[model samples]
Target: MLTEAEKAATLWIQTGFTDRTVIQAAVAEPLLAGQSVVGVAPTGSGKTLAYGIPALSRLVPGAGLQLVIIVPAQELAIQIRDVLTPLAKTLGLGFQGLIGSANRERQVKKLREKPEAVVATLGRFVDLLEERKVVLEEVKTLIVDEFDSFEPDALRDILSFRRGGLPKQANLGLFSATDNPTIVSEFQAAWPDLQVINETSTDNSRGVVHHLLLDRQQAGKIQVLENLAREKHQRVFVFFNHKHVLQKVASELRFKHVPASMLVTDGRQVQRAEALQDFRSGRVPLLLTTDVAARGLDVADVTAVVNFELPDTLTTYIHRTGRTGRQGANGTVYNLGDDHDLRDLRKLVGDRVALETEPGEKKAYRKSAAHSAGADETRGVERQTGAGHRPGKRLTSAEEEAASAKKRKKKKQRWRNKKNVGKHW
Candidate 1:
């Protein structure tokens, strides 16, 4: 029987139409009614607890792996494991992470001992499944967190696990920070009657101020970054597009004596984890990263998000900017781009944000004068060279005409040579 607190929690879950509200509703309604359920929520919205609290409340005392949460990155798996550990302890439920970077032998050994809930990434989870190391037929709940990041291939691998034949009405929860229309539509088509609770509006209540910096050249952008870094002195996340560019920018900052670190996918797992830890612990004030840090990973106390290089896609832009201003903190996003680039970004952000120009600044190209000077020099060269002659040389009209006649004679000779060679062959 559900306790009064749990019942109230369920009621709270059902009342709001936000992402968190919807998730609470799904968890409570299904468990209360003895039916399986799925809950979809945004990133950083306490998704782990939304499903975890209910799963723990409903689990049999020593049941093993009754709930399995699959995430895209190892960082997310570790994060989920951390969130569930205390709750599991209170409920006397066992929990273990089946992440890739961790010791596989140890994970398998832990599995041998039978844990109640297992959090894992898709690749490693599939590996365990293929090895017959985990039995999912008894899995009461399967929560696929960040389903949008799960490519079709990963989803296919997950669907194959159903071959083990789970209960006819097992709970399936797909959670994401983004409510991609295409993903939602496809998901509904697949499940037909899957209940969806849109929580994007509520999830965005975390107090993030978005800004776009336009008409800034690469040099000017670097200056802005330096100024902001010195002024804020808070932990910052600078997102870039290419790995090479990420490293290059970090190197440039270091050259300028700026304390900065970088996290890229190509680095070893330990290195990446250390970078993240340093940034989170505030030892490193600035973190330059690729999209590897954009999704699912949680880093509290980030003061600002600097898009050193703008993301090409809207989803990516949202995720990048969403990193800061999390948990109701007043965080700002600085989008550094040229005018053309800002236009593209504006289209992505739509009317959600208004573009504001920096006050007391005139929009002018500093290189225009230099370009005109170069054009004048080229014209001077042309005047010296005369009409039919190449630049950098003076030629009289008679010399120019003679040169043209000589060129024509050479062309006729070349054509004759080609014709003779063809005839002889």
Candidate 2:
């Protein structure tokens, strides 16, 4: 007889239309059978289902919420919700989303009702725990998605929930696409006998083609962007280091007549959702964003990725570029950088990325900008501007002292003449 997990896996395969071998294996033999498990797989590797299938399979129908998935961002929570919600419905399981910027009152009410599963962000989950609005006593399985992204404070808050008490034999699963050596080592040290599943080396090389373009200046970047936009005509994701830069890039693209939208951390939930939908539907040709959209977003049909500014970490770079080349599709990543960035690019991707030279015209200095032969254009008027005519001229120290002395002498002479006039009076 097939086990409950097997039954769920079969249903998932039919509904989702892909066979996840590792996920199936994990479900067949759960990590909590005496040990913890950490799965390191790249984006679009069906990680959510890897943990979700086993979690939902373990749930008893009509029981209280027993599973919780903690993600890094609210957008990711929603993405996971969208994917797992269908499976939950198919299996007749109830789930609730506990992310930020949602109806907190409704979430509190739902917690009282006790759904079968809860997907949430770390901060909001901590808030709920502090408010006593949600109890984790019934949670037998906890999945922390993108564990590498969790800061020390958030991790402490997560551990604090145990202060209230935890399940006797609760299972913990940590999943991430990029592996941070320190974080992975720390986690392993904490749980000495944890099982690690690595599927990155095999999966990363099979699908994507990475390209690194060495652009000397902003003009070169704009030129490359325009070329790619016209050629691909597919959903493009452009990443920047700052939110303001994302906004600026989006605005500049729009000004250049490129249909672009932005996704940043400061936007409202509905606004982010609408922007994502617009990009996914091909209504927006370019999607400008920061690292907020780098991880856990499952936008289909992203054809190319442009790194307007490279991220500081290798994990960030991988996740940013992972937006494209999904699901065995032939996608391209263009890294736009100046000469100073080439060394970092080489260290991150090695020789895997093809190096392309900037155009000659792009490298050549502009003749128009060089000092023209005759008069200079000043506020649309011709002026004989030169080094002498330029503002901020400074006097020598000696010249300054002599001018002061002359003024002092003239003042003294005027006072003496005034005294003589007084004597004559």
Candidate 3:
């Protein structure tokens, strides 16, 4: 029951994105009829093709740049361009992969040439807009991919583009696998008439991901990741919250002959190119990165994702693990963090985390992760005691009085509750 254009669209997909809900929903009249779309679909669910096909199909070649795609990271921009550029060339449509590290002068020259589409990192795109006379007057569609993970810099560039010379009538689309309620609220408030399309799997996770936790310190976590990389084959994305930690982990891995590379926002172009080449070609087996690679970065046979540190929020956790277990394929994710991280994860996702407690040596690992759910009250008490306390100084007059009063009040409240329970018993 495919229309001619739909059939043509499906024919262009080399990645076998033929039977996805996103593709169907995107091509429907509503989306093509200028209804701004907020597509919340699972990772590896053909989200790129869902929007890309329709966007490309609407392209009138040589009509000055018609489509503008904004991605959060440089690598994402490069990856999307890799997917769309060939298809564009096939259709006689021109597009440019605009990146900051790449030749900006050449990119400007391409902008002057007015490619039919521009897949750009938010920072580079903004810089180009300032330095060059790029025309957005002919732009008809605007796409912000990975909306949740957009950094402050990217968001700033997007706000400027939204309020700047770009036509108000341009079709707008915001897409990501992770749904941030705050961002969703903001988008809805901004575009009251936007059509919100959610095809995210009933269970947010796609593959048979093992929601696991490794209760280890920072050094121990690196060792665990190394063990995973050496044991099971294929690429592994080891994520750290801090860049310093990421680099340190990578250095340790390399120092121990584990061939680890750092993939971060500020990584050099040559390094990025080599890292991707090695990853795709199986030359480099392990990549240490920050949240930069969390969303929409595709590498074949990335069977697992390792969280060197548990992400701060549930949204981040979902996306980080969503990297693996994509497209109904089986994958695994191992999260490493302290007791609080494990507890918070249990609270947020419930039993979605299938913490693996293997035989032999992993018995203790299982025990370490056992009390995650029940440790909440204890953790809370620890936080109150250790938070913001100076190492070698007594509390000031005001602080001493406040601390004593607070402790007294807490003690009294606990005794009262305990007495009440005793009376009932």
Candidate 4:
């Protein structure tokens, strides 16, 4: 009694996957039937394949641009393309990606071949549409990944695309980890009969995440990172509040011979790809980045997430911590800051996050980090307690106090800079 699309999905699952996840199973039939759907699932819950498999199953080979998937970031677009390539191949479908940084001429050339599917970022996709390089008349399904992350202007563009570019009978799919009511209302207004599938209530896809606090002075954070890097099996994502701190920490770690990668929002695309590849392939164990660059990052082996400093908002906190403990993989979240920062983090997350506070579980890691300072010295880099100078010997109490005062001043400046960012300094 299986439909063709269901039978195709069964083949895909039998090929490699063990079984369909809840979100995947729920949305497959509807999506395959060409019905519009909004799927909300937890992070790393295989939303890609949930929508991707059904979409591909419904595609006709050699069709010109039948499926258009819009993502918020270039990296995510590439990730999806890479993930679905094998599946697309199995279905005899040609898939391609349109990202802002990739060569425009090359993309246009590829478009002439009549690819069946295209994954893209909004900016580049819009540009192609404006240039008449892409035709949506034949498009059957349009998917927007991470719908909640789109800005207002981008959302307007998406609405315009749905109205003007796409065919009247085309299906729309929106997927995100969290749903904002206002955005959902806007979509519902646009498509009054849109179907919503919120799996968060019964979603058991996320693994256990140990939220532990590492209450250390700013100077000692680098030493702790060094300690973590010594662990060969740990792949950590270190989040920072500012790009400057990320740059400094990355530089210091590299100077100490730690194989760490740095990813920035405005960096060159090739370098960004290289950095991500290095981390993904286990060539480097640490990836230090800010929120913008790390958004929607889906790496399976990320065993730990380190908050170099707490994020500015709760949504940001959720996105950062969600990087770990993904897809039923047990992971750890280490919040690295002073006591004041720890209190602020608790206030920011409220009852949503459970921080480990037991003496044995929490204090054990702190004790280990403190004792590892001596171990770091054997690598020929002295323990750094603050920015600027590296003294040959350890600092006295007065020096430590002065360093703490300077650190406080720097934090205030950072806040001011953040508030005044994008304005004339």
In terms of lDDT, which candidate is strongest? 4
Write candidate 4's Cα lDDT for 359-400 as tens digits: 212333335664455334422221121111122333223345
TM-score of each: 0.76, 0.78, 0.78, 0.82
Give the alpha carbon lDDT tens digit for every residue of 1-425 in model 2: 55665756665775665555444355336542434678887777677877777677777657776888999888899888887777776667788899988988888987776778889998788898778777778878778898888888887766565556557566778888877677666655545666777777666423544453444355445544554555445788888898877776666666666677788877888988899889888888778887765468878877778888877777887787777777777666667766558557767766544433322212222245432321133211211211011222222233343453355346744311432211110
The residue-level lDDT of candidate 1 at 271 comes to 89
What TM-score number comes out for model 1?
A: 0.76
1-425: candidate 3 lDDT, tens digit per residue: 55536634554565465454653555455556666888887776667766777777677778988899998778888888888887777667898898878987777766777799989877787777786556678888888898888876666567566667788778878888866677767666656777777766553436455555545555446545555555536678888889888877777777656777677777788887777777778777787778875457877667678878777777777777777776666676667665566666667766645554211122223355445433443334323422111122222222333454356346754212332211110
Candidate numbers, best TM-score first, in rank order: 4, 2, 3, 1
Worst 10 residues of 1 by lDDT: 416-425
Which whole-number lDDT from 0 to 100 does residue 49 have in model 4? Answer: 90
Segments of candidate 2 deviating more than 4 angstroms: 21-28, 31-35, 188-192, 351-425
**lDDT (Cα, 0-100) at 122 in candidate 3:** 75
Q: Residue 72, candidate 3: how far off, in angstroms?
A: 1.0
**What shift in Å separates residue 146 of candidate 2 from its native position after superposition?**
1.1
Model 3 TM-score, all chains together: 0.78
- Candidate 1 lDDT, tens digit per residue, 1-425? 66635744653454343445445544555554444334545445566666666765666656656888888887788888887777677656788999777789998998887888889988888889889898787787777887777788887776666556555455666776666566656555444555666666644447545353435556545544555555444878888988888877777778666677787766777987888888888888888887755567778867778888998877677777777766676666677776677767777777765544322123343246554565455344323422111223222133333453356346754311332111110
Clash tally, candidates in order: 3, 0, 0, 1
Q: Judged by TM-score, which candidate is best?
A: 4
